[model samples]
Target: MLAGKRVLLIIGGGIAAYKSLELIRLLQKAGASVVPVLTRAGSEFVTPLSVSALAGHKVYQDLFDLTDEAEMGHIQLSRAADLLVVAPATADLMAKMAGGRADDLASTLLLATDKRVLAAPAMNVRMWEHPATQRNLATVLADGVRVVGPNAGEMACGEFGPGRMAEPAEIVAAVEAALGAGPLAGRHVLVTSGPTHEPIDPVRYIANRSSGAQGTAIAAALRDLGARVTFVTGPAVVPPPAGVAVVRVETAAQMLAAVEAALPADAAVMAAAVADWRVANAGAQKMKKDGSGRAPALEFAENPDILATVSRGALRPRLVVGFAAETEAVVDHATAKRLRKGCDWIVANDVSPATGIMGGAENAVTVISERGAEVWPRMAKDAVARRLAQKIAEALQ
Candidate 1:
């Protein structure tokens, strides 16, 4: 999608700066010409020689180089690219951009550029969550600047939360999405993700091993295709993709509420593994482990089925896709699920412990529609998502 595209990459100073090498390579492999502008702090982590070697071009690192200025002025340099991308966007750099401080080459280019700018933030979790940083992020978003991760994960610091920059491949996908002509442009898509929790007590809950990778991938793919995605997700291991609206929930009831609120979308993908039952009378406080001779018996109640409700709603989506994770008779069960849920299609995958599909990178799935079932070979979750997004686009057309 990026063939013949010009990507102006700005590498910021952070531990995650190393990933920019791979990012440059990926962009070049995808036929993109990369022009790298390294910040002074960015030079401390990765050498200019290294970036120049990988990009196969001279790396620009100054705001006032006589030779550079004589050839192409800073204004021309800033406006030369189709898009501006910042990897490992440090907290300091983000704050500078938010406050319009163009003290250095990178920040100056950011302020001078008229092209769309995208950033993948990397910082300590605390730093990312600081009130100042939060305010800066809000300002950047409000200004129509596209931001990717700063995803939640174990950080270089011993602490863990959302502060990691997205992987190189993921960032490349985001770049392509930003630059590619959106196939589903101007469309709104609603997607649900993760395994809904059913609380039994304050300290205990029932849930499944849905990492939400598939759902997150689907949302990203749809965004790549130019769709405005509203992601209603449960407690997902992965963060929602960039440039999309995310509504977070934990339980089936909360998921239902979120889904209902994101109504009238062109399509809905019910990819969440919602719990079928919840405690009839959940304890408000932690249930003590009393030394009772007899075990406590708990009552169970059915939870709302989000897919069925949406499929049968008055504002029914034009395209409705559900997921069926089964251990046996995958195709049959998925077909039955499509009929039972009244959805237009069902994506069936074997999540049995033996298959290692859940919480894993690769997936083998069969997409069952009213026409028939089409089994896809095992592939990366992102590939599956792209294929599904294309299919959805065709269906919408």
Candidate 2:
């Protein structure tokens, strides 16, 4: 999708700087010509020589290099690319950009550039959540600068929480989404993701293996296509995309309520693995293991089907998509599910224990519509989401 695009890649100083090298390789593989801009501190983590070697171009680092400046002024250099990407965008750089401080080459180019700029922040959890950083992020977003991720996870410093940089592949996809043709602009898409938890007690609950990756990806992809997305997600490992309205819920009932609230959207993608059943009468406190050796019986009640509910609503969306994850008879079961659910389309995939597709980086899906079923080749989940988003855009047209 990025073929022939010129990417001005600015590497910042952070532990995640190493990922920039792989990002360069991926960008080039997708037919993009990368121009490397290394910050002074960025040079410390990854050498300019290494970046140049991977990028297949001379790396630009000095702002005062008279020879280079005379050949291509900073103003010209800044506007030379289709997009400016900052990977491992440190807190310091973000602050500078947020405040319009152009002390270094990277910040200077960022200020001088007219092209769209996307940043993937990498920092400690505390640093990311600090009021100063938060304020700066707000300023940049208001200024039309795009932000990708500082995903939540274990940090390199042994501290666990948010603040990890997005993976190279994810960054690439974000870039494509940013630069791709916007066919879904002005469209409103609502998506549900993750596995809903049905609590039996304070300490116990029922859940599934859904990581919410696919659904979140779909939301991001739709956002990239210029659609305003309302993402209704359960407790998910991955963070939702910026520039989208995110509604968090924990149980199937909560998810249904949130989805209903986000109605009148152009489309709805029900990718959440909502619990089939919930505790009939959940206990408020934790159940104690009594000395009596008898196991307690738990009563169950069926949860609402979010997809079917939305499909049958008075304000039904123009297109409704649902997911069916099955171990056996994948296509057959998925096709049956599409009819029963009354959704316009169903994305079916096998998530058996042996496949490891569930909560994995890749997926193989069969798209079932009113016409028939079509199986897709195994690909990254993000790619699958993009293809599906594009299909939705086409259908809308």
Total backbone collisions for each predicted model: 1, 0
By TM-score, how accurate is candidate 1?
0.69
Q: Which of the numbered candidates is closest to the native, going by highest TM-score?
A: 1
Best by lDDT: 1
Q: Residue 90's C-alpha lDDT in candidate 1?
A: 93
lDDT at position 149, candidate 1: 67
Q: Worst lDDT window (10 residues) for model 2? A: 177-186
Model 2 segments beyond 4 Å from truth?
1-61, 66-83, 86-104, 111-116, 119-181
Q: What's the TM-score of every candidate structure?
A: 0.69, 0.68
Candidate lDDT (C-alpha), each: 0.89, 0.89
